[model samples]
Target chain A: MEKRYLDYIDDVVSRIDTDSQTKNKIKQSLTEHIEALIEKHGSLAYNKLDPVEKVAWEFSENLQLQDRKEYSYPWPRRYPVWRRVSQKKIFNIPLYHITDGYNPETGEFEIARGIFAFGPVALGVFTAGGIALGVFSFAGISAGVLLALGGLSLSALASLGGAAVAGLFAAGGMAVSFGLSIGGFAVGHIAIGGEVFGEYIYKTTTGEGNAVEWFRNYLPYFVKFFQ
Target chain B: MITIEIRKELKSGVIELAILALLVRREMYGYELSQKILDLSSGQIEVKEGTLYPILYRLEERGIITSRWQAPLGRGKPRKYYYVTGKGRQYFAGYRKEWNVVVEFMCKILE
Candidate 1:
C-alpha cells in the first residue's frame, strides 16, 4: 500500500517541470500529507473513508488521465518572481512598461520596473520570465550582471543552472568560469567535477562527488594563501 | 444541487482567502490545514490535494507564505509546515474588506 502511494507520487512528480529543489519539496510535502491521511483513516485499503481518501484517489486518477493524454504539467504556482510592477508606474512616475508583443525588427522589447516582470528582452533591476537581462535575472535564458540563475545562465560574477558561464564562479551540469567551477563537466582556474580540466583540477570518476564540500574544505586555505 | 463545475469555480475563488485566513492564526502542515478547512466549514467544503497544493505553491511564490520542513520525533518522515507572512496578513485584511463589501452588496440586490 505504501509502495502504491509512493508510485503515484513519483508519477505525478515526474510529469512536473521544475528545479530539483522545488520538486523535492513538493514530493516531501505530498508524502507527509498522505502519511497523515493513512494514519487517520487506518488504511489506504479502507472501503468507506473520509474526504481525504476520496481526494487522494481522485488526484491520482487525474494524474493518470493527464499522463495518458500527454498533457504538459501545469507550471508550478510557486515560481519565484523577482519584482512586481503595478500599472506601469512607481509612485505615479512611469518607471516601466511591458510591450504587448515582441517585435525584434521594431526592436521594441519589454522594459519593466516591478517585483516581477516578463518580456522578450526584460530589463529591470530584478526581472524574470523571458530572455531576462538584469542585475538579478531569471528566464529560459538569462544574463545577470552580478548573479545569474536559470536553465542557461551567463553572469559577470556567479552563476548556477544546467549550463552556466561566469567570469568568477559557476556551478551547473556544464560550467565554465574564470575563477572556480563545479559541475559534471567544468573548466576554471579551480575546477571540480566528474570531468574537469583546469589549472587546479579535482576530478572524480564517481558522479556523486561533492563539489560544494570540496570547495568548503579548500576555499578558506586558498583565501588565506592569497591574502 | 449545484453543478460540480460551478462548485469547483466557487471553491477556487475562495480557497486562497480561506487558506490565508487560517494560516494567520497558526502554522499548519498540508494535511492538517485541509482537515481544519473541512472541520471548520462543517464538511461543507472539502479541499483536495490536487487543488490545495497548487494554491499553496502559488501563495509561497507570491511571498505571501513561507514553509520549513520539521523532522519527525520518532519514526515518521519530516513534514513541511507553512506560515503566513506579514505581507499575507496585509493582503488578507484588504481581501476580507473587499469580500464583505461584495457580500453586502449582493445580499442587498438579492433581497
Candidate 2:
C-alpha cells in the first residue's frame, strides 16, 4: 500500500511542470484531501472493496475539467482569470513594458500580480539595469567615485526592492511588507562593496579598456560560473 | 446515496489524492490511470486528460514523485511515466494514519 501510494504520487507528478513553491502548495492541499478520502473510504478487504477501485471511485466524484476552447463559462458567471497576453498590450509604446501595477486607490504595489503580467521581459530589463549600474561604478575618478558609490547603493536598494516586489507577486500577501523593508537595507551594503571593488579596478592598470570590452572579457566567466 | 453537493465537495477534496494513490501501485500511464479509476469507481469517476495533468504536475513539484519520457506503449501520444519517491512514501504514511483516525472518529459518531 505504501509503495502503491508512492507510485501514485509519481504518476501525478509526471503529469505537471509546476515549480517548487507551487508544488509545496499542491502537497499541502493533497495531504488534506487524502486524509479526507481515507476517512470516507478505508481498506478494500475490510470494506469488501479493492484499493484501486475505491480510490478511482472517489476521484471521479470530485475532479472536474472545463474545456474553454470547447465551451465558455456562461456570461455573468465569469471568474477573473490571470490571462497572459504580451506586455505590448498595456503601454503600446516600444520599450514600455509595464504590465501589472498596484491599484491606484490602494497606493501600494502588488509585486506578485506584476510578475504574473510582466513575466520575464520586465524582470530582465530591471535586472540588466541594476548590473549596468553596478559595473559603471568602477570606471570613475575620485569625485566620480563618490557619485558612483551613491548610484551603486541606490541600485542595490532598487534591485532588492524589485526582488521583494517580485516575491510579493509570487507570495501574494503581507509577506512583502516585512521582506521589502529589510531587503532594501541589505541591497545598500551590497552596493557599498560593489563600489569599493569598482574603485580598485579604476586605479588598476587593467582599467585601460572600455567598459564594454571589459564586460565582453568577464561576462562569459560569470555566466559559466552561474551555469 | 450522496447528493450532488456532497459529490462536488468530495470531488474537490479527494479526486487528486485518489488518482495519485492509484498510480502508486504500478507503472500505468495516463490513459491507464484514467481507465483504472473509472473501472474501480464503476463509472462513478471519470477523469479527462487535461484536468489530470495539472494535478500530476502539482504532485511532481514536491519531489514526492518523478517522471520519465517513454515510447508509446499501445496508443495515443508518447507518454510520460511516473514513479513514486521516498518522500512520497513518508507522506502517504502520514496521510493514511490521519485518514484512519478520521474514519474511526466518524464511524464512532455514526454508530
Candidate 3:
C-alpha cells in the first residue's frame, strides 16, 4: 500500500521541474496531504482511492476557466475572458482553442494551440490573435508560413499589413520582400511605392531614402513558385 | 444540468480564492481546510481528495501562504498548518471586491 502510494507521489513529483530540493520539499508536502487523506478515509479504505479518477476533472468537456477583467488575450478590450476547447484534435493538439491569460506564478501568457486558435498568443494551422504564428495568420504581430495579414506580419509566401515582409509578395505601408512589393516605402526585386528600392524600383508620390539591402534564404522557393 | 460542467470548470481556479478566503478567517491544516470547505458549502466545494497539496504548494510558491509544523506539546504527530501571508490578505481584499461585484451581477442576471 505504501509502495503504491509512494509511486503515485513519484508520478506527481515527476511532473514538476527537476530540482532535487524542490522535489523533496514537494514530496514532503504531498506525503502530508496523503496522510491527511488517509486519516480521513481510515487507512483501511485508503488504498481503494485512485488518483487518475480524481484528475480527469481538469480536462473534462464542461471545464470553464474564467479570467479576470484585466485580461483580454487575443483582443485587449474585455473585462473577463474565457476559453473553450473542442474535443477534436490534430497531432494531439486541440482542434480549436480560445485561451488567453497570464499565469500568476510564471507570468507567461497561456499558449493556445489548435487548428483554429484564437487567444493572446496562438499557434495553429489558421490563427488570429494578438501574437499569432501559423500557416495562415492575422494579428497585431504575426508570422505565417503561407500568408500573413495584420498590422505587422512576416510570411514565407505573402504578407499584407501596415509593415509587411515576405519571400514572394508584400503589400503594406512599409513593405519588403524578395520578389514583389507595393507600399509607401517598398523594397523588393520589383518595388512600387512613394520611396522604393530594388533591382527595379518605381516612385509614385515622390520620396527619398537610402537603399537598404536584405538577405534571404527562401528566394529559391519563391523563384520556383513564380515559375 | 446547467451547473454540472459549470461547477467542474469553475472548481480549480476558484479553489484558490476559497482557500485564501478561509485562511483569512483562521489558519488550518490540509484536512481541516478541505473539510470546512465541504461543510460550509454544503459539500458543493468537493475537492478531489489529495489534490489540495498541489494547490497549497502553488499558494506557498507564490508567497501567498506559509506553513509550519506544530506538535501538541509533546503528544501526537506534528501537522503542517497553513495561514495567509500579508500579501495574500491584500490580494484577497482586491479579489474579494471583484468577486463581490461578480456575485452581485450574476445574481441579477440569473434572476
Best by TM-score: 1
Q: What is the lDDT of candidate 1?
A: 0.68
Clashing pairs in 3: A64-B9, A69-A79, A73-A120, A74-A119, A74-A120
| lDDT of candidate 1 at residue B36, scale 0 to 100 | 92
Q: Write the per-residue lDDT of candidate 1 for residues A6-51, one digit (tens) a residue.
A: 7766665544433456557668766777788877776643333334
For candidate 3, give the lDDT of residue A87.
68
- Which ten contiguous residues of candidate 3 chain A have the minimum total lDDT? A56-65
Evaluation by lDDT, superior candidate among 2 and 3: 3
Predictions in order: lDDT: 0.68, 0.38, 0.71
Chain B TM-score, structure 3: 0.84
Which portions of model 1 show Cα errors greater than 4 Å?
A15-23, A45-227, B1-8, B72-75
CAPRI verdict (incorrect, acceptable, medium, high) for model 2: incorrect
DockQ of each: 0.19, 0.02, 0.16
- Which candidate leads the pack in lDDT? 3
Root-mean-square deviation (CA) per prediction:
19.0, 20.3, 13.3
Docking class for model 1 is: incorrect
Cα deviation at A25, candidate 3, in Å, is 3.8
Q: Could you tally the backbone clashes for each prediction?
A: 8, 14, 5
Model 1, residue A116: what's the lDDT?
A: 50
